[model samples]
Every structure is written in structure tokens, then in C-alpha cells.
Target: MPFIRSAGLRGLRATITSLDGDADHYARLGGLDPAALDADDILMPDLAAATTLELAAADLDCPDLGLRVAGHQDLSLLGPLALAIQNAPTVAEALECTSRYLFLHAPAMRLTLEPDPDGVDGVAALRYDVTAPGVAPPPQGTDLCLGSLHRAIRSLIGEDYEPLGVDLPHPPLAPPATYEAFFGAPVRFDRPSALLRFPSRLNDVALTGSDERVRQLALQHLADLSPAEAALVAPTVRSAVDQLLGTGAPEIGAVARMLSLHPRTLQRRLADEGTSFALILDEVRSSVARRYLETTDLPLSQVAGLIGLSEQSALTRASRRWWGQTPLAVRRVAQSQRTVA
Candidate 1:
């Protein structure tokens, strides 16, 4: 099955909640766990995720549901993909990185930059497509992807950056004015693909806060994380645990369900590999907790919640076990190193 990183659905729950709809209900109806959408970088069944978007939009009577979800998210939703893009020195390089590594985000998706097809002067087009077989990209999913892309481009170039034109492969989901107001450009539907036309000169614009070393490191990390061959049981289990963390303490059965394995089978496989579920869960929590402390200014309670702890006390205990210090102390040390560097 073609899979997308769960980050693709980052704002789904929030958008549905904001629209006075039951997000979990839609998720279940679409054959997914509601909590699965909350995790970043874990693989999710692409068609099921897309169907959830379609169902929510149709049932909630919100034609622009995808765009609304996009509004709730930013580049951070892309995880390491965002890291690579933000550190790239120029708009062109950042876009090139995105085109090359988008498969890391969604195996079935494609992003490309091409010359404007209309023979317009000094113009270019950024095209987005989903290459999954047996069906066209659904409208809501397309809207979410394109809306997020538009915002990402604006952030990369300038706040004033607006597409010259927007093209969609399906009929307008809402009034034409709705897309125009959101995109700040004319939108044409029934096009061959989703294309955002912009000034070609903008590609050379230098990005702020870009570090070449950081960009290269992020690219290497992404390359290492990419699914290149048949997956192993432990890494897949680790990913499932990571995905379930924010929902709560991950259970073996739940993890097994995520992997489509019986709990006993999962245990046997782990044992065969000289490990167990508990060990993997601990490693995931420890790694995630450390990363949050070192990289973000999030409160201790929030960090605890993200790593599946119910309270700061649990995190405090875990931090002591892992690092022999409080989470605050870890953050302080990391900050000091960054400042010195």
C-alpha cells in the first residue's frame, strides 16, 4: 500500500473540531485510528487518510475543509522535510530539495517545478500531483496539499508572494471567490493538474536563517529515514509507538493493530530479534523526550504529554532515569552549547 507520513494529516483533528464535527467519528468511518493523525513522520494508509478528508468535508457541509485544515498547520508539520527546506539557502534549492524528497512525506505524491506552459514572460509553475493508481487525487486532499504548499512558498520567499495563477484538476469545490481570497490569485479548475504559477525570478531569492551545514545534515537524516527496502519489525514497531505516543501510553495490542499483526505474533517477532515491545517503547520515549527538551521551548507538561506521559512528574522521573537531570537542566545545557557555537 502507498503510505503518507502521518504529518500530512497534522491539522485534521483541529480543523474538524473547529468546524463542530466529530473528528474521531470520521476517522473511524474511514478505517483509521483518530490518534494516528496526530503523529508526525509515521506512515499512514494514504487512501484511507484521503477518504477521511473527503468524508469530513462532505458530511460537515464544508466545501473548503481542506483549506481550513491547511490554515491550522505550518511547515513544522513536515517534520524533517521542513528542516531541510528551512535551512536551504535559496528558494530554488529549497524547492529542489522538496521535489526530490517529497516521497519521504508521501510515497504516492509528486512535486515538480516546470516552465510556464502558457508562454508567459518570466513565469514558472510549481506542479503537484498524486500518482496513486486506481483513482484520481480527491479534492479535499488536493486542497490541503496545495493550500499548505502556497503558505510554505510565501514563508520561504516573502509574505507578499502570491501565485500568478492557480490551476486545479477538479471543479471548484467552493465559489471561485473563496479560492481567490485565500490564494490572492485567480484560480482555474478542470486543469490537467494542480499548478501554481509564480515569478521565476523569485526562485533565486535568498532565504533568511539558512545554514548550509544544517541543510546538508537534514538531507542526510531524511535519506537515512527513507523507506528503501523491506522494513524490519523493530523499526516498524518503533514508528508505531511514536505515532501512538501523543494519544497515550502505547499498548502492545494497539501497536500490533497499527502494524496489522496479532499481539502474540508481534511479541514473538520482537523476541526473535532479541528485543521486546517494552524495550522499543522505552527507547522511543527516551529519544522523543530528549529531542523535545533539546530542540523546543515547549513546557515540561507539554513535552510529557507528547511523549505519552500523563503528567510532568512522570517525565521528571524518566528524565532522571535517562539523563540524571531534570528536563529543564537538559534544555539549559543544550541552549548553552548552541549559544557557544
Candidate 2:
């Protein structure tokens, strides 16, 4: 029954050339005036409805047409923007450029790079983070944004670039079919946070000569971005997770209290979205484990504690269930990958 927001409607308008059929479909499903639906509001439907719309639009065969109509219109904007970043002067500048300009097109999202001391030696990697407004979350918009960003960057540089892994805040259910094909890496769910990781060498690439002036100009343009432009979507739940994660052993009841909802209500809502608390917990633990394995000298036992696992044995058991491998085995694979790269 929730309607899409006006901002979302406006954003969708930028991508969609016409809303004729889309409007009729929405009117039939939502029993409202499709013309009255704002671009942002168009994506306010439940996940299943949204996914069906996305798939149907894509199958319609228009150029970037499907992406345009998707409720999270940010995916359509990231492509050209990432291409611009790839043309920047150096890897450092390219990353900086991406971090800076990404908001101009997508808003509410930031990409950062940090140096890894242990994993991949001295390689620096980029992280994509989304910040949106209100208690309502962005749904799967985060994944779409990350996927589009990855595809754009790969196209600009070269397809051999390793795809970034994501740390989702919910359990996996019926994810989009193109997810594995596009991400080309593991996608962990119900994690404490979302993340994207790749080797830092891509940062060394020289920026296209013509882009330097544009980068400077874009910086000035971004300086004017409003706080609402970087709105934090689903702040209530995100804040609850933030506080709970600090405790090392957060309970669902505790989290529910923090969000001012009964545990039963929380569970129902999460189920409506096809996720659960246990799945989110495993996702967070798995992601933290991977990051520790790839980026630090932390022992397996220590890594387990960081992600709320009480003992190494428990961590191993959970990892095997989620990934069909032991934590050490996963680390070994990552190590081998680093060696090959």
C-alpha cells in the first residue's frame, strides 16, 4: 500500500522515455492512478512486484530501457558516471573522481578506497557504500547500483577486472538471476554491512588526459550537493544494526526493541521481504571472515570473535554451511587468487 516517493518518481523520469504501459500496469496492480505515481514512488511496491516489473521492462528490448524503469533508477545513472571516473588522471584520481562524482548522478552513495596492509600485499581497494534517507530501506537498489558500477568500470578499463563482493544486510532468497553472472563473486547476505572489494592495482591506471579539467569542474559541482542529496535511507534499521553490531552478540529481541517494534512484527516484516535474522547474521559473519582473511594477520579464532562467533569451531561450522568450505579453506583460495593475480 506504500506509495513511491516524489524524489524516486523524478529520478525515474530521467531514465524512462515514456510511462504509458508502465502506468497502466501499476494502476492495475496498485489500484491507483499511475499518472499520480512519482518516479521514486514507482519502486515502492513490494520486492516481488518490483522484480517482475524490472524483468518485464528489460525483456521489452529497449536500449537501457529496462534499467530506466527499475524502481532504483540509480543503476541507470552509474554507467556514464563510472566511465567518466575511469578517464581520470591516475588510479588515485580515478577513485577520488568516482567518490566525488558518483553523488552527482546517483546521490546518497559513496565509494571509498583503503589500503590493505596484509592481503594482496600493498594493494588498495575500493568500497561502495550507499546512504539514503528515512526508515524505509532502498531494498535491493544497493545491489543494482554496485552491479552497474562494476559493469561500467569493467567496460571502461577492461573486463578482466575482478568484480567486487557485496555484504548484504538480509538473507538470500530469490535473488535476481543476473546477480551471479554480473558480480562474478560471492554475495553474502544478512551481514552487519555491505561492501565491495577488488585489487588496488586498478588504481594505478593513468587518467585520460582530457578528463583532468572535467574532474576539477566536477569537484566544484559536487560541492553544491545538498544533505538531502546524500540522504540516509532506512536510518532506523541501519542505526539499530550499527548499535547492535557493536555488542558482538546482538540478539533479535534487542534489535527489535531498539527499532521500537515487537520481535514478532520485525520477523514478519523481514519475511515479507524474503529475509530473516539468522541469514543476516551469517552474512555479516561470513563477510567479516573474508575481509579478515584477505586483509589482516588475524588468527581464525580472533576473526570469529570479531563477527560474533563464540568459538573457532562455531565459526568453521557456520562458514561450511554458508559457503561449503572452512574459513581456512576460503582464506587459502583467496591467497591463491592473490598469488595468481
Q: Which candidate tops TM-score?
A: 1
Candidate 1 lDDT at 114 equals 71
Worst 10 residues of 1 by lDDT: 129-138
- Residues 5-86, model 2: lDDT tens digits: 2333333333433643454453345343455344332333333334433443444443233234333433234444444464
Write down the TM-score of every candidate.
0.66, 0.46
How well does candidate 1 match the true structure in TM-score terms?
0.66
After superposition, the stretches of candidate 1 with alpha carbons farther than 4 Å from their true spots are 227-341
* Residue 238 displacement in candidate 1 (angstroms): 33
lDDT tens string, model 1, 1-341?
78887888888998889889999999999977887877886777988888999999999999999888888778888788899999998899999888767777787776767768576989999888764422456888999899999998887777757689998866788898999988999998755567899999889988999988988899989889866532458866865686577678999999899789999999998998899999998887987687567656778998898888999999999999987999999989977865773
Q: Residue 144 error for model 2, in Å? A: 1.3
lDDT of 1: 0.83
Task: Provide the overall lDDT of each model, using Cα atoms, as 2-decimal numbers.
Answer: 0.83, 0.53
Instruction: List the pairs of residues colliding in candidate 1.
Output: none
